[model samples]
Target: MTCRLPAALALLILPALPAGAQSLEDSAARLAELLRAGRAVISENQALINDPGLGDKGLTPEAFLSQVTAAFLARTGSPAVSEDLPPFQRALAEAQLEAMGQTIAEAQPLINMEGVGFKGFIPAVFARLANERFGELADGRAAVKITAPPELVRNRKARPDDWERAVIEDRFLSAGWTRGEAYAEETGPGFRMLIPEYYSESCLACHGSPAGETDVTGFPKEGKAAGDLGGAISITLRP
Candidate 1:
Protein backbone atom coordinates (compact mmCIF):
# COMPACT_ATOMS: atom_id res chain seq x y z
CA MET A 1 0.00 0.00 0.00
CA THR A 2 3.04 2.22 -0.17
CA CYS A 3 2.55 4.54 -3.14
CA ARG A 4 5.41 6.91 -3.91
CA LEU A 5 3.83 10.08 -5.28
CA PRO A 6 5.71 13.32 -5.82
CA ALA A 7 4.35 16.16 -3.68
CA ALA A 8 4.24 18.53 -6.64
CA LEU A 9 1.79 16.21 -8.35
CA ALA A 10 -0.66 16.60 -5.52
CA LEU A 11 -0.92 20.22 -6.57
CA LEU A 12 -1.09 19.47 -10.30
CA ILE A 13 -3.78 16.77 -10.16
CA LEU A 14 -6.68 19.08 -9.49
CA PRO A 15 -6.50 21.26 -12.57
CA ALA A 16 -5.81 18.37 -14.90
CA LEU A 17 -9.00 16.49 -14.14
CA PRO A 18 -11.53 16.34 -16.97
CA ALA A 19 -13.53 19.53 -17.40
CA GLY A 20 -16.48 19.53 -15.01
CA ALA A 21 -15.57 15.90 -14.37
CA GLN A 22 -16.48 16.01 -10.74
CA SER A 23 -16.35 18.25 -7.73
CA LEU A 24 -12.80 19.55 -7.49
CA GLU A 25 -12.65 19.13 -3.75
CA ASP A 26 -14.15 15.69 -3.93
CA SER A 27 -11.95 14.64 -6.84
CA ALA A 28 -8.84 15.86 -5.08
CA ALA A 29 -9.89 14.05 -1.94
CA ARG A 30 -10.40 10.82 -3.84
CA LEU A 31 -7.08 11.12 -5.62
CA ALA A 32 -5.37 11.68 -2.34
CA GLU A 33 -7.02 8.60 -0.90
CA LEU A 34 -6.03 6.43 -3.81
CA LEU A 35 -2.49 7.80 -3.70
CA ARG A 36 -2.30 7.04 -0.02
CA ALA A 37 -3.26 3.49 -0.79
CA GLY A 38 -0.75 3.28 -3.62
CA ARG A 39 2.01 4.43 -1.30
CA ALA A 40 1.03 1.79 1.21
CA VAL A 41 1.42 -0.76 -1.55
CA ILE A 42 5.08 0.19 -1.99
CA SER A 43 5.72 0.38 1.73
CA GLU A 44 4.23 -2.99 2.57
CA ASN A 45 6.13 -4.76 -0.18
CA GLN A 46 9.38 -3.11 0.85
CA ALA A 47 8.95 -4.46 4.36
CA LEU A 48 8.37 -7.93 2.99
CA ILE A 49 11.47 -7.72 0.81
CA ASN A 50 13.62 -6.65 3.74
CA ASP A 51 12.25 -9.13 6.22
CA PRO A 52 14.91 -11.73 6.83
CA GLY A 53 12.22 -13.89 8.34
CA LEU A 54 10.41 -14.05 5.02
CA GLY A 55 13.61 -14.98 3.23
CA ASP A 56 14.58 -17.45 5.92
CA LYS A 57 11.21 -19.07 5.60
CA GLY A 58 12.16 -20.08 2.08
CA LEU A 59 10.01 -17.39 0.56
CA THR A 60 11.42 -17.08 -2.93
CA PRO A 61 11.29 -13.87 -4.92
CA GLU A 62 8.56 -15.26 -7.12
CA ALA A 63 6.54 -16.24 -4.12
CA PHE A 64 7.02 -12.85 -2.57
CA LEU A 65 6.16 -10.87 -5.70
CA SER A 66 2.99 -12.83 -6.12
CA GLN A 67 1.97 -12.27 -2.55
CA VAL A 68 2.93 -8.63 -2.37
CA THR A 69 1.69 -7.58 -5.80
CA ALA A 70 -1.58 -9.24 -5.01
CA ALA A 71 -1.77 -7.12 -1.92
CA PHE A 72 -1.10 -4.00 -3.93
CA LEU A 73 -3.63 -4.92 -6.59
CA ALA A 74 -6.20 -5.46 -3.92
CA ARG A 75 -5.49 -2.18 -2.20
CA THR A 76 -5.32 0.08 -5.23
CA GLY A 77 -7.94 -1.85 -7.16
CA SER A 78 -5.64 -1.62 -10.16
CA PRO A 79 -5.60 -4.45 -12.65
CA ALA A 80 -3.25 -7.24 -11.61
CA VAL A 81 -0.29 -6.36 -13.80
CA SER A 82 2.00 -8.66 -11.86
CA GLU A 83 0.45 -11.66 -13.57
CA ASP A 84 2.24 -10.51 -16.72
CA LEU A 85 5.55 -10.50 -14.87
CA PRO A 86 7.67 -13.51 -14.13
CA PRO A 87 7.34 -13.76 -10.40
CA PHE A 88 11.11 -13.53 -9.99
CA GLN A 89 11.42 -10.34 -12.03
CA ARG A 90 8.49 -8.75 -10.30
CA ALA A 91 10.00 -9.43 -6.92
CA LEU A 92 13.34 -8.09 -8.05
CA ALA A 93 11.76 -4.81 -9.21
CA GLU A 94 9.86 -4.53 -5.98
CA ALA A 95 13.00 -5.04 -3.95
CA GLN A 96 15.00 -2.67 -6.12
CA LEU A 97 12.46 0.13 -5.72
CA GLU A 98 12.46 -0.51 -1.99
CA ALA A 99 16.21 -0.08 -1.85
CA MET A 100 16.05 3.05 -3.97
CA GLY A 101 13.48 4.50 -1.59
CA GLN A 102 15.87 3.83 1.26
CA THR A 103 18.69 5.62 -0.54
CA ILE A 104 16.49 8.70 -1.03
CA ALA A 105 15.32 8.56 2.55
CA GLU A 106 18.93 8.47 3.72
CA ALA A 107 19.65 11.58 1.69
CA GLN A 108 16.93 13.40 3.62
CA PRO A 109 19.33 14.36 6.38
CA LEU A 110 21.59 16.07 3.91
CA ILE A 111 18.66 17.99 2.37
CA ASN A 112 17.80 21.52 3.40
CA MET A 113 14.41 22.12 1.80
CA GLU A 114 10.72 22.21 2.71
CA GLY A 115 10.13 18.77 1.25
CA VAL A 116 11.96 16.49 -1.15
CA GLY A 117 9.68 16.86 -4.20
CA PHE A 118 9.33 13.82 -6.43
CA LYS A 119 10.42 15.08 -9.86
CA GLY A 120 14.07 15.38 -8.91
CA PHE A 121 14.46 11.85 -7.66
CA ILE A 122 13.72 10.21 -11.04
CA PRO A 123 17.37 9.93 -12.05
CA ALA A 124 18.75 8.98 -8.68
CA VAL A 125 16.03 6.42 -8.11
CA PHE A 126 16.50 5.04 -11.61
CA ALA A 127 20.25 4.91 -10.99
CA ARG A 128 19.74 3.12 -7.73
CA LEU A 129 17.29 0.66 -9.27
CA ALA A 130 19.62 -0.04 -12.18
CA ASN A 131 22.54 -0.60 -9.85
CA GLU A 132 20.58 -2.94 -7.62
CA ARG A 133 18.85 -4.77 -10.46
CA PHE A 134 21.15 -4.46 -13.46
CA GLY A 135 24.47 -3.94 -11.67
CA GLU A 136 26.71 -0.94 -12.50
CA LEU A 137 24.62 2.21 -12.71
CA ALA A 138 24.02 3.76 -16.16
CA ASP A 139 23.63 7.52 -15.89
CA GLY A 140 26.33 9.44 -17.75
CA ARG A 141 28.53 7.98 -20.51
CA ALA A 142 27.26 4.53 -19.73
CA ALA A 143 23.70 5.56 -20.55
CA VAL A 144 24.71 6.88 -23.98
CA LYS A 145 25.98 3.39 -24.68
CA ILE A 146 22.57 1.99 -23.76
CA THR A 147 20.70 4.73 -25.55
CA ALA A 148 16.92 4.72 -25.83
CA PRO A 149 15.70 4.63 -29.43
CA PRO A 150 15.24 8.09 -30.90
CA GLU A 151 11.58 7.28 -31.44
CA LEU A 152 11.12 6.81 -27.74
CA VAL A 153 13.05 9.77 -26.35
CA ARG A 154 12.06 12.26 -29.03
CA ASN A 155 8.45 13.31 -29.85
CA ARG A 156 7.81 14.72 -26.45
CA LYS A 157 4.17 15.38 -27.32
CA ALA A 158 3.29 11.92 -28.56
CA ARG A 159 1.93 9.44 -26.04
CA PRO A 160 2.84 6.12 -27.55
CA ASP A 161 1.35 2.73 -26.81
CA ASP A 162 4.40 2.15 -24.66
CA TRP A 163 6.83 4.44 -22.89
CA GLU A 164 6.44 8.02 -21.68
CA ARG A 165 8.91 10.65 -20.62
CA ALA A 166 9.69 11.00 -16.92
CA VAL A 167 9.09 14.67 -17.40
CA ILE A 168 8.24 16.79 -20.44
CA GLU A 169 11.46 18.76 -20.16
CA ASP A 170 14.95 17.38 -20.84
CA ARG A 171 16.54 18.90 -17.75
CA PHE A 172 15.54 16.18 -15.30
CA LEU A 173 17.99 13.68 -16.70
CA SER A 174 17.28 10.16 -15.53
CA ALA A 175 18.35 8.03 -18.49
CA GLY A 176 17.00 4.87 -16.97
CA TRP A 177 13.58 6.45 -17.25
CA THR A 178 13.61 6.09 -21.03
CA ARG A 179 15.95 3.16 -21.72
CA GLY A 180 15.64 -0.59 -21.07
CA GLU A 181 13.41 -3.25 -22.65
CA ALA A 182 11.39 -3.40 -19.49
CA TYR A 183 10.52 0.28 -19.20
CA ALA A 184 10.97 1.92 -22.60
CA GLU A 185 8.92 -0.39 -24.79
CA GLU A 186 5.83 -2.51 -24.48
CA THR A 187 5.67 -5.34 -26.94
CA GLY A 188 3.55 -7.36 -24.55
CA PRO A 189 6.79 -8.97 -23.42
CA GLY A 190 8.09 -7.36 -20.23
CA PHE A 191 7.74 -5.06 -17.21
CA ARG A 192 7.37 -1.27 -17.04
CA MET A 193 6.71 1.35 -14.40
CA LEU A 194 7.93 4.86 -13.55
CA ILE A 195 8.80 5.18 -9.89
CA PRO A 196 9.47 8.90 -9.37
CA GLU A 197 10.85 10.42 -6.18
CA TYR A 198 9.70 13.69 -4.64
CA TYR A 199 12.18 16.52 -5.01
CA SER A 200 14.32 17.43 -2.03
CA GLU A 201 16.47 20.56 -1.71
CA SER A 202 19.38 18.15 -1.53
CA CYS A 203 18.44 16.87 -4.99
CA LEU A 204 18.17 20.44 -6.30
CA ALA A 205 21.67 21.03 -4.99
CA CYS A 206 22.84 18.57 -7.60
CA HIS A 207 20.27 18.19 -10.42
CA GLY A 208 18.95 21.72 -10.07
CA SER A 209 22.35 23.23 -10.48
CA PRO A 210 24.34 22.94 -13.69
CA ALA A 211 27.33 23.33 -11.46
CA GLY A 212 26.37 21.38 -8.39
CA GLU A 213 27.69 23.12 -5.31
CA THR A 214 28.13 19.76 -3.60
CA ASP A 215 29.12 16.42 -5.06
CA VAL A 216 27.10 13.27 -4.67
CA THR A 217 28.94 10.26 -3.25
CA GLY A 218 29.98 8.96 -6.67
CA PHE A 219 29.37 11.71 -9.25
CA PRO A 220 31.85 14.53 -9.79
CA LYS A 221 30.79 18.17 -10.15
CA GLU A 222 30.00 19.85 -13.46
CA GLY A 223 28.38 23.35 -13.50
CA LYS A 224 25.79 25.31 -11.53
CA ALA A 225 22.30 26.66 -12.46
CA ALA A 226 20.06 23.57 -12.67
CA GLY A 227 17.82 24.64 -9.69
CA ASP A 228 15.05 22.58 -7.94
CA LEU A 229 13.81 19.77 -10.17
CA GLY A 230 10.51 19.12 -8.42
CA GLY A 231 8.03 17.80 -10.99
CA ALA A 232 7.00 14.45 -12.70
CA ILE A 233 6.74 10.66 -13.32
CA SER A 234 4.94 8.69 -16.01
CA ILE A 235 5.29 4.96 -16.84
CA THR A 236 4.08 2.71 -19.65
CA LEU A 237 2.54 -0.78 -19.57
CA ARG A 238 1.53 -3.73 -21.73
CA PRO A 239 -1.67 -5.73 -21.56
Candidate 2:
Protein backbone atom coordinates (compact mmCIF):
# COMPACT_ATOMS: atom_id res chain seq x y z
CA MET A 1 0.00 0.00 0.00
CA THR A 2 3.07 2.24 0.45
CA CYS A 3 5.98 2.85 -1.92
CA ARG A 4 8.59 5.42 -2.99
CA LEU A 5 8.34 8.45 -5.25
CA PRO A 6 11.39 9.94 -6.98
CA ALA A 7 13.10 13.09 -5.76
CA ALA A 8 13.10 16.51 -7.43
CA LEU A 9 10.09 16.06 -9.71
CA ALA A 10 7.82 18.83 -8.49
CA LEU A 11 8.09 20.68 -11.78
CA LEU A 12 7.38 17.75 -14.08
CA ILE A 13 4.82 15.52 -12.40
CA LEU A 14 1.39 16.61 -13.60
CA PRO A 15 0.25 16.12 -17.15
CA ALA A 16 -2.66 17.58 -19.11
CA LEU A 17 -5.74 15.45 -18.80
CA PRO A 18 -7.65 14.16 -21.73
CA ALA A 19 -11.17 15.39 -22.38
CA GLY A 20 -13.86 13.57 -20.43
CA ALA A 21 -11.38 11.58 -18.40
CA GLN A 22 -12.72 9.39 -15.64
CA SER A 23 -13.36 11.00 -12.29
CA LEU A 24 -11.19 8.34 -10.72
CA GLU A 25 -8.17 9.55 -12.67
CA ASP A 26 -8.88 13.15 -11.73
CA SER A 27 -9.05 12.37 -8.04
CA ALA A 28 -5.99 10.16 -8.16
CA ALA A 29 -4.02 12.74 -10.12
CA ARG A 30 -4.88 15.51 -7.67
CA LEU A 31 -3.70 13.43 -4.74
CA ALA A 32 -0.47 12.77 -6.56
CA GLU A 33 -0.02 16.52 -7.08
CA LEU A 34 -0.42 17.17 -3.38
CA LEU A 35 2.22 14.57 -2.52
CA ARG A 36 4.59 16.10 -5.06
CA ALA A 37 3.97 19.52 -3.56
CA GLY A 38 4.94 18.23 -0.14
CA ARG A 39 8.17 16.88 -1.60
CA ALA A 40 8.80 20.24 -3.27
CA VAL A 41 8.55 22.08 0.03
CA ILE A 42 11.02 19.68 1.65
CA SER A 43 13.49 20.06 -1.20
CA GLU A 44 13.45 23.85 -0.85
CA ASN A 45 14.44 23.67 2.80
CA GLN A 46 17.28 21.17 2.60
CA ALA A 47 19.81 23.78 3.70
CA LEU A 48 17.78 24.72 6.78
CA ILE A 49 17.29 21.06 7.65
CA ASN A 50 21.02 20.43 7.42
CA ASP A 51 22.11 23.60 9.20
CA PRO A 52 24.46 22.67 12.01
CA GLY A 53 24.02 26.05 13.70
CA LEU A 54 20.23 25.84 13.89
CA GLY A 55 18.26 23.96 16.51
CA ASP A 56 14.68 24.66 15.31
CA LYS A 57 14.08 25.25 11.62
CA GLY A 58 10.41 26.07 12.31
CA LEU A 59 8.96 23.65 9.77
CA THR A 60 6.05 22.41 11.86
CA PRO A 61 3.14 20.55 10.28
CA GLU A 62 1.02 23.69 9.87
CA ALA A 63 3.91 25.76 8.56
CA PHE A 64 4.92 23.00 6.17
CA LEU A 65 1.32 22.57 4.96
CA SER A 66 1.12 26.27 4.13
CA GLN A 67 4.26 26.01 2.04
CA VAL A 68 2.91 22.90 0.35
CA THR A 69 -0.31 24.71 -0.55
CA ALA A 70 1.59 27.59 -2.08
CA ALA A 71 3.84 25.21 -3.99
CA PHE A 72 0.83 23.36 -5.39
CA LEU A 73 -0.85 26.59 -6.46
CA ALA A 74 2.28 27.88 -8.16
CA ARG A 75 2.88 24.67 -10.03
CA THR A 76 -0.67 23.68 -10.97
CA GLY A 77 -2.41 27.06 -11.06
CA SER A 78 -5.13 25.64 -8.84
CA PRO A 79 -5.84 25.51 -5.15
CA ALA A 80 -4.59 22.25 -3.64
CA VAL A 81 -7.87 21.49 -1.93
CA SER A 82 -10.30 23.18 -4.21
CA GLU A 83 -13.77 23.94 -2.85
CA ASP A 84 -15.40 22.48 -5.92
CA LEU A 85 -14.03 19.01 -5.36
CA PRO A 86 -16.52 16.19 -4.87
CA PRO A 87 -17.01 15.07 -1.27
CA PHE A 88 -15.05 11.89 -1.78
CA GLN A 89 -12.20 13.63 -3.58
CA ARG A 90 -11.98 16.33 -0.93
CA ALA A 91 -11.95 13.79 1.85
CA LEU A 92 -9.17 11.78 0.27
CA ALA A 93 -7.13 14.91 -0.46
CA GLU A 94 -7.39 16.07 3.13
CA ALA A 95 -6.42 12.63 4.38
CA GLN A 96 -3.31 12.73 2.23
CA LEU A 97 -2.38 16.13 3.62
CA GLU A 98 -3.01 14.95 7.14
CA ALA A 99 -0.74 12.01 6.54
CA MET A 100 2.01 14.29 5.33
CA GLY A 101 1.65 16.62 8.31
CA GLN A 102 1.87 13.77 10.78
CA THR A 103 4.95 12.40 9.05
CA ILE A 104 6.79 15.74 9.18
CA ALA A 105 5.73 16.46 12.74
CA GLU A 106 7.14 13.15 13.84
CA ALA A 107 10.47 13.98 12.19
CA GLN A 108 10.84 17.38 13.85
CA PRO A 109 13.70 16.36 16.16
CA LEU A 110 15.72 14.70 13.43
CA ILE A 111 15.23 17.54 10.96
CA ASN A 112 16.24 20.18 13.51
CA MET A 113 19.28 18.34 14.84
CA GLU A 114 22.49 20.33 15.29
CA GLY A 115 25.91 19.66 13.75
CA VAL A 116 24.38 17.48 11.09
CA GLY A 117 25.57 18.26 7.58
CA PHE A 118 23.06 15.87 6.01
CA LYS A 119 20.19 14.32 7.91
CA GLY A 120 19.30 12.41 4.77
CA PHE A 121 15.92 14.14 4.62
CA ILE A 122 15.82 14.25 0.86
CA PRO A 123 12.61 14.58 -1.15
CA ALA A 124 12.49 10.93 -2.12
CA VAL A 125 12.83 9.80 1.48
CA PHE A 126 10.18 12.21 2.65
CA ALA A 127 7.82 11.10 -0.12
CA ARG A 128 8.30 7.47 0.80
CA LEU A 129 7.65 8.06 4.48
CA ALA A 130 4.66 10.27 3.85
CA ASN A 131 3.18 7.69 1.52
CA GLU A 132 3.49 5.05 4.22
CA ARG A 133 1.49 7.26 6.54
CA PHE A 134 -0.98 7.98 3.75
CA GLY A 135 -1.75 4.30 3.31
CA GLU A 136 -2.60 3.98 6.96
CA LEU A 137 -4.63 7.18 7.08
CA ALA A 138 -6.50 6.33 3.92
CA ASP A 139 -7.61 2.99 5.34
CA GLY A 140 -7.28 1.15 2.06
CA ARG A 141 -9.50 3.52 0.12
CA ALA A 142 -6.51 4.83 -1.84
CA ALA A 143 -2.72 4.85 -2.04
CA VAL A 144 0.10 6.82 -3.69
CA LYS A 145 3.71 5.90 -4.41
CA ILE A 146 6.78 6.65 -6.48
CA THR A 147 8.96 4.01 -8.03
CA ALA A 148 11.58 3.73 -10.74
CA PRO A 149 13.19 1.32 -13.17
CA PRO A 150 14.89 -1.69 -11.58
CA GLU A 151 18.49 -0.54 -12.03
CA LEU A 152 17.66 2.91 -10.70
CA VAL A 153 16.03 1.69 -7.50
CA ARG A 154 17.89 2.29 -4.22
CA ASN A 155 15.41 1.11 -1.63
CA ARG A 156 14.16 -2.42 -2.14
CA LYS A 157 10.85 -1.23 -0.76
CA ALA A 158 10.67 1.25 -3.61
CA ARG A 159 10.98 -1.36 -6.28
CA PRO A 160 8.14 -1.21 -8.82
CA ASP A 161 5.91 -4.27 -9.04
CA ASP A 162 5.04 -6.06 -12.28
CA TRP A 163 2.31 -3.58 -13.19
CA GLU A 164 4.45 -0.49 -12.60
CA ARG A 165 7.46 -2.09 -14.27
CA ALA A 166 5.46 -2.93 -17.38
CA VAL A 167 4.10 0.60 -17.63
CA ILE A 168 7.51 2.19 -17.06
CA GLU A 169 9.37 0.10 -19.62
CA ASP A 170 6.71 -0.58 -22.23
CA ARG A 171 4.98 2.80 -22.06
CA PHE A 172 6.68 5.67 -20.25
CA LEU A 173 10.14 4.80 -21.49
CA SER A 174 8.96 4.08 -25.03
CA ALA A 175 10.33 6.61 -27.51
CA GLY A 176 6.93 7.01 -29.14
CA TRP A 177 5.02 7.76 -25.96
CA THR A 178 4.07 11.35 -25.28
CA ARG A 179 6.25 13.03 -22.68
CA GLY A 180 4.64 14.14 -19.43
CA GLU A 181 1.55 12.07 -20.13
CA ALA A 182 -0.03 9.88 -17.45
CA TYR A 183 -1.26 6.37 -18.09
CA ALA A 184 -4.31 4.97 -16.32
CA GLU A 185 -6.49 1.86 -16.54
CA GLU A 186 -8.47 -0.57 -14.42
CA THR A 187 -7.46 -4.17 -14.37
CA GLY A 188 -6.65 -6.84 -11.78
CA PRO A 189 -7.20 -4.80 -8.68
CA GLY A 190 -8.33 -1.21 -8.39
CA PHE A 191 -8.19 1.80 -10.65
CA ARG A 192 -4.53 2.76 -11.21
CA MET A 193 -2.73 5.75 -12.66
CA LEU A 194 0.91 6.64 -13.21
CA ILE A 195 2.26 10.07 -13.97
CA PRO A 196 5.62 9.97 -15.66
CA GLU A 197 8.53 12.01 -14.22
CA TYR A 198 11.71 13.03 -15.94
CA TYR A 199 15.14 13.88 -14.54
CA SER A 200 15.24 17.65 -14.24
CA GLU A 201 18.33 19.79 -13.72
CA SER A 202 17.66 19.69 -9.99
CA CYS A 203 17.48 15.90 -10.04
CA LEU A 204 20.93 15.70 -11.69
CA ALA A 205 22.81 16.49 -8.49
CA CYS A 206 21.89 13.11 -7.11
CA HIS A 207 20.49 11.13 -10.04
CA GLY A 208 22.78 12.47 -12.72
CA SER A 209 26.15 11.88 -14.32
CA PRO A 210 29.32 9.96 -13.44
CA ALA A 211 27.38 6.77 -13.47
CA GLY A 212 28.06 4.38 -10.57
CA GLU A 213 29.60 7.17 -8.45
CA THR A 214 28.11 7.64 -5.01
CA ASP A 215 25.75 10.55 -4.47
CA VAL A 216 24.72 12.31 -1.26
CA THR A 217 22.62 9.46 0.09
CA GLY A 218 25.40 7.03 -0.88
CA PHE A 219 23.52 5.72 -3.89
CA PRO A 220 25.27 5.53 -7.23
CA LYS A 221 24.17 8.08 -9.81
CA GLU A 222 21.94 6.81 -12.59
CA GLY A 223 23.90 8.99 -15.04
CA LYS A 224 20.57 10.12 -16.39
CA ALA A 225 20.13 13.48 -18.09
CA ALA A 226 17.30 15.96 -18.02
CA GLY A 227 14.16 14.69 -19.84
CA ASP A 228 15.08 11.05 -19.42
CA LEU A 229 12.36 8.76 -18.02
CA GLY A 230 13.35 8.83 -14.37
CA GLY A 231 10.29 7.63 -12.44
CA ALA A 232 6.51 7.65 -11.97
CA ILE A 233 3.94 8.55 -9.35
CA SER A 234 1.62 5.58 -8.99
CA ILE A 235 -1.91 5.94 -7.59
CA THR A 236 -4.47 3.31 -6.70
CA LEU A 237 -8.11 3.77 -5.74
CA ARG A 238 -10.13 0.92 -4.32
CA PRO A 239 -13.11 -0.35 -6.25
Q: Give the top-scoring candidate (lDDT).
A: 2
lDDT of 1 by residue, 1-239 (tens): 25633322222231232233123222222222333333344344443333433323233334434554555457657533344443322322333334334444443332223322222323333333333322222111011111222232222332323233433233235544443112222224322333223434544444445543454433433332323223233322211
Q: Which stretches of candidate 2 lie over 4 Å from their true place?
A: 1-21
TM-score of candidate 2 to 2 decimals:
0.89
TM-score of each: 0.26, 0.89
lDDT of each: 0.33, 0.82
Which parts of model 1 are misplaced by more than 4 Å? 1-127, 130-167, 170-198, 208-214, 218-227
Candidate 1: RMSD over Cα atoms? 15.8
Question: What lDDT does candidate 1 reach at residue 7?
Answer: 24
Per-residue alpha-carbon lDDT of candidate 2 for residues 1-239, written as tens digits (9 for 90 to 100): 13323211211232323334488887888888898899989989988898889999999999999999999889889887766766557667777778889889999999989888799998999999999888877666678889989888888988999999999999988889999999998856878899988889999989999998999888999999998888889998772
